[model samples]
Target chain A: MRDQPTGDQLLATARDLLREDVLPTLSGSQRHNALMIANAMSIAMRQLQSGDEPERRELAALGKILPLPESHGLALQQALTEANRALCRLIREGRADSGQTRDQVRALLLETTRQRVAISNPKYLG
Target chain B: MMEETLRQALAAFIAKETGAAEARISEAKLLTGGAVQENWKVQVDITGGAYAGVLDAVIRTDSASGGVAVSHNRAEEYALLKAAFAAGVTVPEPLWLCADKAVIGRPFFVMLCIAGTAAGHLLVKDARYGGDRVQLAERLGMELARIHSIRPPRPDLAFLEWYEEAPALHSVGRFRRYLDSHAIPHPALEWGLRWLERNAPPRGDIVLSHRDFRTGNYMVDENGLTGILDWEFAGWSDPLEDIGWFCAKCWRFGAKGREAGGIGEREDFYRGYEKISGRRLDRQLVHYWEVMAHAAWAIIAIQQAERHVSGEETSLMLALTGHIAPELEYEILTMTEPV
Candidate 1:
């Protein structure tokens, strides 16, 4: 649906320009700022490349434990946020402390957190 | 003219405080790397007084937005520094505190400027500083022991509220309350808090814990540590809390191999601490608090991100700090989960 230079591609190019071309010329705090900008651009590019898969997967995982409505009229992000809130409530209530439920919760948290790390800083995962 | 005015004001204040006939402050320059506070370096020349000598000192004041919710104010921090200094901890000598706002438009304190690099990444990587990592780690442990020697039930630190619950539980409750106030839910962090609450060890002797006693909070010259810095987050808690925080994997930066603040082995640091404290540490509790360390850092990272996200303060560093939450969450999960 988009043009040749896609969102991810655009971000990747911008990051390259700042990290490789412009960063060498800068110094001190300016260099630090440029590096941070480059890091943000990289993260944005990864998020775009990964798309909504991480969110959808997380929601599907959350739906397993909670009685999520089949036809709840909400956008994906909103639904995901609500599902996470429910999960947090379950954790606080100590409902996720048992055998099977604890395992399920742990798995979901690990996968979702890993996905976020993939976008934020994959080096940490490695 | 503004610089001249500040110089004159500072010189006058120093003269009055130190009983110097003449005091001149020169090369008053602001230092970097304190997100919540401003540190200004100044050279003071004193004449005809007991303190008649050239001195390098640091003037610390709140930034425009002040500090975090849990930290001490300037006056309290000055008192804490003096206490720590008296306790024989390797801290900067607290010289004077100016509470009068008219002096610098905000409350500020001055301490003897310590010489060393407090940069975390550089300290971990550059062998120039941490070449003799064993000695450095041991010295750090000894310094921490000195800090832990200062107990509570004192008039000077009466402002610090004595928690009814165990210190670990108290911290978990605090973090949970903060999360409740936020717009979004942190399920990962909630899980961490739940785990921490469920498995918290029994209450130990509540000594003064350097809450932020991590690699980045201290300084290191080539010879070794010059002085411990950033007592803003210091408080009364379990002694193991500081040790756990020192060895936490998150605090190790990228040098994960060297567990003690990415500087040396945990054995050496613990050995130094045990030598001075004369108490054996529960190694299991240290692990639990290491997990808690990540949780606490996650909460702090969230708050830092909120400062940017809420449009209160726009800083790239703060935003980036928030991005670190996922890694912290992953760490919490790894540490809490069974092998």
Candidate 2:
């Protein structure tokens, strides 16, 4: 059997197809939909590659704002860890309000993570 | 418990007033885009109200969660809308205000629905109405200038407090406090704030300021701008703030080449404003506020994104708002750094 295409290969192929065959052909509402879909895909790929770094950095930053009892570095790490755990619990319990709060916590974490990653890993593309 | 009960109460109240007894109230979905308050599309058929036609009115109220300092109370906002409408600004007519908590669990107002489009990207992209865009942009500028020209002797509207004082310092402190409350660290934003503080613009002749004058905030029809919505942030300040805000890059809706509401050149808007106001354009002041406008928008975007992430509200729009921070930051950096 022929070797299966790797995830990267598949993503590249899909992107190329979208840019060449799909985007050029679209018009009106179809063009809008295609553009939105392409944008979503690009975001998804970027998130997959560099999303975690932002999360870590954001957690660290949060620690500075709302100081925990632990040391700075540990607090940063723990606060983020606790935030994730809290989010997991809220999701599992199906608490709608809590879910919303968790989203804010997650956003802060992710944003901080992204900024930190950008500073640390200059070559990282998103 | 409250949301469902509130909806029922609201329907009952509206039904009683409108005299449409058979009106069936169904599905009250909370609409997005109002940052400081909540807006919902309440679909109901007339059963027994004073007016017999089917009613589709937007119910607006203060949000339970995070809200900004400058947000007017529902009654106040309604009053403002009525006053603005009276002044010949195209606005949805304010219908009713309910302060009774038993009705909607908070103070809220209802307004007649105006049919028009407000999406900036869609407006810019649609080739059918491309020719009208520049003319519409100019009209919008002129109309805004008209709004600023309104000097109030009316008893209903409260006189703006900071009219006599230097507004730049006040704004600097106000924005600084807002940033401090959020406690998000941004050295660049802080630097911009400091720059504004150090080089505060001299207080010019004061007039009305539509604090958030931008493309998306306005309503447009086939002819041109029909209405300018979202006066929650409206107040008295330097008129240039409004002009600068309208011309700011963030409001350009992804069309970089066209500057005036991303529809035409800045001169078109400037010419229109000059025609209406009888004042020569201050290019330097407009440039300054344009930088500040982006900074303000960036902060707002951050706040909006925060709501999505913090779980107060979750929507794709909010998520996208967060993504715009980088672009806004870049704008501030470029504007502030000397050539």
Candidate 3:
């Protein structure tokens, strides 16, 4: 059997197909749909290129800041998740009023969300 | 015949005293920009009710579910509309409010349909109407100032529970609450939230704030602004919030150079607001809230996109709304980053 294309090769092929073949044929709503799909695909491609290292780095950063017990992988994830949930709860209760309090919570939350940016696709940062 | 429903409701509620039955209802279509609420074009032909002629009206209702965190109920919206129309704010005249779910599957209200264009791009692009753009923008600013001057104290209007000492801080919290409710992760939006929290403007005098004050939210005629629609986000807050929101880049209708809804400069808008209210414009406060305005909108864009992805309400419009986040993020970065 022929060897399968690598992930990068597959993404390159998709990008080529979108620019050369798909986009030229699309019109009206179809054109809009094609552009949107292309955008999502480009983001997915970028995430693959970076691997999950960004997530791991962010998790390690979270482990340093938050109050998590010293287990490495899953514990870090759980701590990050708990921090996000706690912040969300505070926001829901409308308690994030003080500037310093809001700043601390937002810093923690931003760090957590930044780590997960790979899942949301980097091209979305455009 | 439930043909008498409109007639009877109007007679009992509106005091129009019509005994006619609606022979037919037609021309029904959904109006855009009411994600938390809905408006449907409702045309009725009355045969024997107290009213005898065909009438064009809009049926406003709660959405399948409330999409926004702080949307007022249908009855509350109707009351606010009636109060504003009575205060001469140029709104469609509210006719009747039906809280019963039997008639329309949800709480719904009816209002007289006013004829005017509400599309911002069409207003800016069509040369026939384009000449009136700057003048209309100024007039809109003046009219908004007039709206701000209205100080009704009815119980229905006094429901907002903003923090007494620090309204600006409370506003930031409310926006954060809205974002948290959706639970979608956005690094850029989180950054915006953090920026706004760190740079919160000091609270100023409170006024009746139309939370969504912008070009697409208003109706325009050949002369000027005819009415401001979408009062579901109305509440008591710092008036500069409305001013900053009106001048935000997101509402510029594709004309990035024109700050005032892509129709005029900031000077013209400020002059109109000041002339009408007799209050000097605070440039610094306006600029600060303008940043907050974009932050709030960024969260809203995320929520809209999430609605489509979550299978809550799937539509091309919702999907396009999600695309606006990139531009919003760029605005936030430029506004709050260290100089």
Candidate 4:
């Protein structure tokens, strides 16, 4: 809404320029560096494209697992941090090892990790 | 030039260490591809003495920064390379170690550099090495078996802690403790760790494990593997740990089709290992350790990313490594979660 080229669009253009236009001219470590920059840009673009959907979904999943107040006046990132810390405690204490809890925890962890992988490296999903 | 000064120092050190009358170093240049260590390629020509030949060698020393927590120091790495060389593991011949800080302002060691490419992507992608992938994979397995031939209870390897329980359990516990200390709370990684802990096989005869034995760590040429490099992470553990680590999907460098280090099939590697060690690889046990491999790599990726994130050593490579964590975590879930 603000401009013609959005954040993700600009990032995608830059990444393509680095990979297709600039990368072929370089070799050895310089090429490797350029490729890494392109990779980082690509991940950033993916995150932007996905928006806050992954974060919101993760929070929803965490709310069911952790004893947290829904609709609390906490930021999504803060809520995630608190929920993950509590989940870690439960896992470490062996409370989430067996029965229905383990299945829920596993499913949530898998879903959350899938979201991360989708942003970071979608090719790895297969 | 700085190169001339380093050359003179290196020649003088070589003369003193080998009791040579005179030694001259030439063509000294830094080699790439060791995030934690610096390797300088040098040609050393010695006059009449016990060491009296022109040699293409590598001067390996610690980098200014970005050393892994689990790796050995330069002196220790020199000893490890020496032990591997003595065991005929196709490693570079360790020549001399200079522990004196006065020599190069840090500890360093020189070894005879061999010919080959150690780039994982190149080896996995190139069609030139396609014909010999099976043989190369088997030879690597045999070489690993030879490395495992060196068992524990040695006075030299006394620094390595022995595990009375299963070494797999020890590895799981160590990684869990590392994660707990960080307190970052990676549920997928935790799930993998829990699986590893529960499925750890009984401790077999503890042998020297090349903890980082994988595709990227070895050198291969048109003919075959020239040298098995990087001995800093070598330690005593279950032999199968190396096998799992070698075949781990994460280390395949995008050549996931060829499971054995992305070079050849697993059966050939296992057959080669069994031929030497007389012990068959347990497929199920190896699978558990493979899960552990992903978890361990994820932890390392996190640590590498921290080096950049914490501003301790700002490196693009380290920063990129952090992006690999989610992928590794995803792989851990696929392997450990009920499917």
The whole-model lDDT of each prediction reads 0.88, 0.69, 0.69, 0.84
Which candidate wins on lDDT? 1
TM-score of each: 0.97, 0.68, 0.74, 0.95
Clashes of each: 0, 26, 9, 0
Better of 1 and 2 by DockQ: 1
i-RMSD of all predictions: 0.8, 12.6, 5.7, 1.2
Q: Distance from true position, residue B144, model 2, in Å?
A: 0.8
Candidate 1: tens digits of C-alpha lDDT, residues A95-115: 999889999998989898999
DockQ of each: 0.89, 0.04, 0.13, 0.74
Highest TM-score: give the candidate number.
Answer: 1
Per-residue alpha-carbon lDDT of model 3 for B164-277, expressed as tens digits? 755567866766666657654444455566656666666666778888988778887676677898898888878888988988887887776888877778888888888888
lDDT (Cα, tens digit) per residue for candidate 2, span B11-76: 777876676666566757777636578888777777645767677778888766536655677777
Could you say which candidate leads in DockQ?
A: 1
At residue B239, give the lDDT of candidate 2.
84
Residue-level lDDT of model 1, residues B222-334, one tens digit each, is 88888888888888898888888899999997999999999898989998898999987778778998998999889999999999999878888898999999999999988
Any idea what lDDT model 2 has? 0.69
Tell me the deviation in Å of residue B328 in model 3.
3.2
Chain A (candidate 3) TM-score to true chain A: 0.61
Candidate 3 lDDT = 0.69
Instruction: Indicate the DockQ of the complex predicted as candidate 2.
Output: 0.04
Chain B TM-score by candidate, in order shown: 0.96, 0.82, 0.84, 0.94
Better of 1 and 3 by DockQ: 1
